[model samples]
Target: MKSKAAIMKTSGKIELGRRRAVWELPAELANLHHKVSIGSSCFLKLAPRPSKHWDARRAAELAVGAGFTLDKPCFFRSQIAFLSVTKIESLPDSVGPKMQTLMVGLNPSPYSSASRVPYGRPGNRFWPAAHRAGLISKDRDIHHALVHHGIGFTDLVRRTTRRAGEIDPPEFRSGFERVKSLIEWLKPKVVCFVGLSGWRIVSNPKAKAGIQPASIGLTTVYVMPHPSGLNAHASLKDLIGH
Candidate 1:
């Protein structure tokens, strides 16, 4: 039988509430410790243990390979999402400050951590369109643009799970306060919310469904579809038009 401490060393490092831990696995399936964990941003889950076959090393490798820290384990039982306890990091201070376009997203995803880049997911199209739309200039280096192009990225919610919809209204409302504080302090020209959810949550408390671009305080807010491949029906042109 594998000891829990042994499993800890083999699991991928993950941040969890002021500390970190290795992802847990069933003691019964300890032989084949080399398999990948699976799931999306809202509800990542492990694959079924294959007939007494799974080992910590395999789990760690899979978690690392799949762009996740083992400590941030995601599990699903009866189709309900279960995320292991973990600490959510504060958004970078650099994400604030004067900008022409502030691109607000729902939250970070697992892949974002792996790449160490925001909006880095292959399926997410926010980067390409934002670049094409003149919001992000080709002439400017990434660091410069982040500081000067008046471009910054933030989220309506800061927590990252397998999916964005997992966030509730209160979470959205709380996120709005943080975003509002950023805007008040940063003083950007235009805040381009990446999706309708952001626009609603950040712009108007009464907003339930969706609404068009509206100004809030000194900032102008614009809404666009989320850039996930799920929005394939929508075109990059549509976002640029906003």
Candidate 2:
């Protein structure tokens, strides 16, 4: 008989394969030869295919009209496609328009994608630090707890990549508009970016990385060390400046 570990391994492999398949959708989008743009720095140039349906054209138009242009290759230099049709379950509840603090990260980890939970990564210290920093009351149901505290979590770029280095600066700039919209709606008083790398992506010429006490777009923007295990210096003290 197969061991329990063997069964678990097979399940894990199957799941990984499924996710890998989803990540490949860009290829299909490219096959349509639809010019598309993602964020501000990327573009796709292609002759519209005869077999393409109207909706594909419409999606392409939306892509181009939203600063996604077939006219240039300034953004996403390697590829271009319409935003993925994210499943409804992929998003959290609509955060209210009165947030006190907001936390932003570079992107979601594969574990977060798998669990459909924000900051769900086990290697990410966001939860523990927030809890200990008095951002949350214990670890009980962190999502609900955060909402209760007028706190919310989001990313600089909503797109998920295997690693943070895969992101482009233009994408962060493009996402800034969306971030502003969130802040306007949520009215968060403090906006904390996850790490130095993230701060640099959206930084002005004068601001430095590490802990910062600054403001951007009607919200106070604070720079904190990333909670990823990769950031060895990202202790609770390092982030909170204690």
Candidate 3:
């Protein structure tokens, strides 16, 4: 008896000898070219002659040489099925309408991301400086910052990184666009970017620590020093002064 694979090849069900091979539908052999399923895989329950009705014997025979079983009371189609999918969550921005000031960060740090809070990293001086400057209450709560002082927080990039150096130019571009959109939407009175580099990414590279000439709709922009423990350009006092 011929091998089932050989029989399939010899029967001209699928081209096998040429450089490029294709399946030959039964409709094509039967001159039923008008059928849209001619070039595509059609659902055939069973039997070599698709016009013939499906039965147990044909399914068993087809299953003998084929990799898959065409079960009884089931349809067969030539398509792979995806079994599972996953979605990723991004960090949330702390912001609201008509805020007095919005503090923008370069990106979330690993510590802040883990705690689901901005500038929550233990060694970071952002919270302390903000408190000292009367921009935040003694409490570390974001709600207190927003409700009491009208100070909101956001980031150029939502993704966390160990260091700002790890972020690429593409991330900077995306972050700048997001912040611009936020400014246009929220219309904060004053937008204070907590990092000069991040603000520069959104504006002129020569941007200083003071006010920026560019405005987002009616909002004004300002740049400040990054409060990371590693940033050595200014003392916390000098950062607050800026």
* Candidates in descending TM-score order: 3, 2, 1
- Clashes in model 3: which pairs? none
Window of ten residues with lowest summed lDDT in model 2: 1-10
Largest TM-score belongs to which candidate?
A: 3
Score candidate 1 by lDDT. 0.50
Which number leads on lDDT? 3
Question: Model 3, 2-111: lDDT tens per residue?
Answer: 11222122232332112211112211211211122312332332223332222333232222112122223333333211111111122345555548998888877767
Better of 1 and 3 by TM-score: 3
lDDT of 2 at 131: 75
TM-score of each: 0.56, 0.58, 0.62
- Clashes (N, CA, C under 3 Å) per candidate: 15, 7, 0
Over 4 Å off, model 2? 1-94, 138-142, 209-214, 240-242
lDDT of 3 at 44: 35
For candidate 3, the TM-score is 0.62
Query: In model 2, what lDDT does residue 47 have?
Result: 24
Instruction: Give the RMSD in angstroms, all C-alphas superposed, for model 1.
Output: 14.2
CA RMSD for every model? Answer: 14.2, 13.2, 22.5
